[model samples]
Target: MAQQLDNDLQFEDRFHRKFYYLRLSVTDVCNFKCTYCLPDGYKPTEKKKPSFLTLNEIERVTRAFAECGTSKVRITGGEPSLRRDYTDIIRIVAAQPGITKVATTTNGYRMEKNVKEWREAGLTHINVSVDSLDPKMFYQITGENMFHKVMSGIDAAFDAGFEQVKINTVLLKNQNSQELPKFLAWIKTRPIQLRFIELMQTGEMDLLFQKHHVSGVSIRNHLIANGWLLKINGKNDGPAQVFCHPDYMGEIGLIMPYEKDFCQSCNRLRVSAKGKLHLCLFGDHGVELRDLLSADEQRTELISRIQGGLKEKAVSHFLDAGNTGMTPNLASIGG
Candidate 1:
């Protein structure tokens, strides 16, 4: 039935990559000063504060995406839980007719305390950023001393009835690259899928990229040699290439954006917190969709704008050629 719906109202790019996943940024303000993305913490602009899409705007936009056959919506932010209406946002997106999975990428700042409410609000999957399992290294990478808290939050999510939780670890060259064994051991008995994401060069992280960028290819090779078998992705799955081991309770995933043909299987589209449609994360710029989001009656035009914008979607990101486009930092558009 879902495949039939996708066939009926497909949102496919010229390359024939059908988008069934949506990465929706609820806000761009993050509290933790992660060394890679935001080293200065979240700074507000001197000009009028940027307006984030409201609850009604979120609903309308989600409805249009659902109509276009998007089945999974991943809510992202500097830290989405920072917004007071975070749970409500989850509720609204989950309530949409065609959206089956409502997930989020969070820092787990409030997860320990509020994850129960968020789960009740209809959040299906959760990815928490745990840069390092070592307390000191975690603090060094994230500039936060809340390693224990975030760990507790992961535990709390399980207690709240979450089946499998995914942990995102940004592979830093000399930092957390050598800690894979530690991560593997932690996930061995737990239902946690540890994802090792290759750090790519954004416009703002040139020097850091040169110094600490570790290719996820190395990790993928390690997994393959260690008897882990690759798993096929579901239609609504994200870009991660997953692998599982017969002995471990958890899995491993590698997200290598710099890998060749990374964009060939692109199945997701990103929307900024301010209602701008980003065709590609490393695309030159975004097309504004806020003007069409003001009223419910404009759903047709909104969907039209989305469908029209796909024509301009590039076949691949130019990261290998050293182009990061208008994306200064991941936090600006919710990486």
Candidate 2:
């Protein structure tokens, strides 16, 4: 335990920002054809199907992260629940020492039937993507005609004993932008947190980004004008700036990547589904970590590599300069 505490204190970067959260992508194959992400649906690699990190590899990486001060791990993917051993994955992550919060971000397609099992597997929290509250707009945005089904899945999550379930809505101009009132009303009587993420420009979506990207700043201004109070983030929290209202049962979180000093308070690191370490979401490239994850005895080397890789992390992503890095789309890295 003392050794773990010592290692925990050593995980900070040059800027003194301590990393306590890990975003671990399990796979890159999504089932949704969201307009912003995969308008043409998921396409397999031309050569062959990509091999994702195995459960053993996932365990090794997660244990190393936990030892290095990561207490919260959010399992993501093109759609993480699509994995046959998804629950087992959750259990494995939860069992790792020092890992206190085991969470996942899913599309909620299987929540109605599998949420209870997931909860039993030790999942501490969940975030479901529901782009729009309106059924028609939801279908149009996600390219799936199952908005109501997803909503039902949220209900199932609550019934399964989750205290709060965050709903992710990518702010798209002229798409679901005008539905804030409807969204606020929907969350007024529920414990749901509505997270509005500004549409980011990836390598493959320049034209679409120019046409539809909406600044989360607009929504932040609206919240301030409407009596919502900004809340300070916890030590191990993610990048969202959360707000709360006295009269509402829910809270609002704004993820404005373009905001000044947005990355200054970054407290998380991301690992790709293929076992590569991404310093930033908009980073130029990833440092391969898979070769160091093949054996249990390789954990010491894995930890050393992770610590060395942190030295190369940039001060900021510099998205304002139009640098989107090698990320062709969000699905490729489980964004």
Candidate 3:
């Protein structure tokens, strides 16, 4: 029952954290310029960076991670669907020897037209980013008025036979935080769990923290105060602290890295669109793997770096501690 690529290698980190989950970003390009992600008046650029990893590099790196005990892999990006051969990449990775589950986090812009293809390609899980239910508010948050279209895509995902769909909502202060209670009631009619994520200390801080960042603690307290009974089920080994209410139709998840740092139980490593292996989200440094991938270096080469970097992986992110160094943008870091 163990996840394995070929029954040869098992990788462990210095912190004794086994890398069973890996999040890989296929591209840094995004269609909508969300205020939290990019600054105002941000121009969309179409030029693809030459250093971005191809489907082949993603396959090789994924194989390496699988060899090291990565069984659950999530494809992430500015928007993973942006890749012309996105489904092809999913098929390639999902078909690997030991990969048990292949998931993706997307903006759901093109999902309606492509969910069936992705499902056929071995995509077993999905997380859609939807901040608000209102079209005007959605556009204000994401800088694009695609709320209806995105909702249609979510509908398509359900119709495509993905048993469990996850909706990721980033609750900003006065912006969409008010949607917390409403969203809880709204998602119950569906077969998906609405996960509220606490804003991480990534990208522009001045624009993100002071105005938007709402603590997960506040949200949970609000839920409890609103006559919601807490019930727990399933595994709590992942990032989100799982919660449920009997009255609600689905479930809820809170990703509070700042309030309750889960770095000690961190089980994943992230691969950026440019093929950099990031040991920690708040870590200032990363291992550049593009050169090694292009060089067709042995798996041992990449494995060696992962093993060495594990020695320096922070026990917890430095966000609250104010010790964080210059961090990469979420798109570049695969957040």
Candidate 4:
């Protein structure tokens, strides 16, 4: 028998999936101009747009989601750490009733400086993006020369008493693919888990896919050839497939958003930096939550809007079929 969704669940659908995870992009400002995420020498638009939601607004939206049964929320951005009041935002989300987890995805350049404050503000988990172990290659990928700073941030995160810290590496052909083994070996010495992400069609990276696409299958094969036996434990509710490598202290995760489609079990909905609600990562359209908030609607109407958006959700994205022009920039939409 299929379980029926609760009436109070604000983001349930006819497909029997209840949306519980919200990825909120706090800001679109970032220090690193990574080749995959942004174009080189990219400049901000002159419209003077506000890139962050106010603390009160973020709290209100988070409370609404909690009331509708969301248990996990991840704060993301071009770089969440770049936000001035990021810690305050973290505290607000963490203080919400029924929120079991509060996490953030960052570039790790500022983690060392803010690790203590973030931990103090009730951040439960941290995922840092580190593409390469070699300093030169790291600079090449992120267009930054601060590899040591990022490494120090990882150490600081551990020292600050975060239970689980994840290091994310976007696997790109001929760029950092050869460094995976070394990257994995280096992470074993730290308390962090290693997650190797397959390049997805988003941002400026999609423009270079033909020249740099590296599939998770290729990464898996490389690991196997290197004497690491990978046992696929199970699929995560999100994109990543968790794997336990034999004799390795830490686990390896493969996020194959390009090669494999895990949209069937996806229960995530995104709230953009601008406050629009997205049903899926590849969704071009979004329900204007900001407009709803500004209209002085009651809580009931706000809940109705979220539920309506969930019903309108598509089952999967078309990008897996070699289409590259569908998804928005990953920074605009949280990862």
What are the lDDT scores of the predictions, listed in order? Answer: 0.92, 0.91, 0.78, 0.77
Worst 10 residues of 4 by lDDT: 229-238
Error of 1 at 312 (Å): 0.5
- Give candidate 2 regions above 4 Å deviation: 1-4, 7-9
Segments of candidate 1 deviating more than 4 angstroms: 1-8
Q: Give the TM-score of candidate 3.
A: 0.91
Cα lDDT of model 4 by residue, 1-335, tens digit? 11234676656777877777889888776788787777553356457766567787788788778788787889998788888899999999999887877889999988889998998998998899999999999999999999999999988998899867888998888999888668777756555678888777764565577778778887677666767654543211345665655566776778877554467677778898888888877775888887555433456678788888777887677677765443545676676
Q: Which pairs of residues collide in candidate 3?
A: none
Model 4, residue 323: displacement in angstroms? 3.5
Model 4 lDDT, residue 187, Cα: 58
Better of 2 and 3 by lDDT: 2
Ranking by lDDT: 1, 2, 3, 4
How far residue 199's Cα lies from its native spot in candidate 4, in Å, is 1.1
RMSD vs true structure, all candidates:
1.2, 1.4, 2.8, 3.3
Q: 207-273 in candidate 1: lDDT tens per residue?
A: 9999999898888888999899999999999889999999999999999988899998999999999
- On the 0 to 100 scale, the lDDT of residue 269 in model 1 is 94
lDDT of 3 by residue, 1-335 (tens): 34534433565566676778888988877787777776453333445434578877888888878777778889988788988999999998998777888999998999999999999999999999999987899999899889999999999998999977899998788888888757876777777888899877665665577768888787778767866555543221358766666666677888987765467677888888888888877788888777667544667887777777677777777678764555645766678
Candidate 1 or 4, higher lDDT? 1
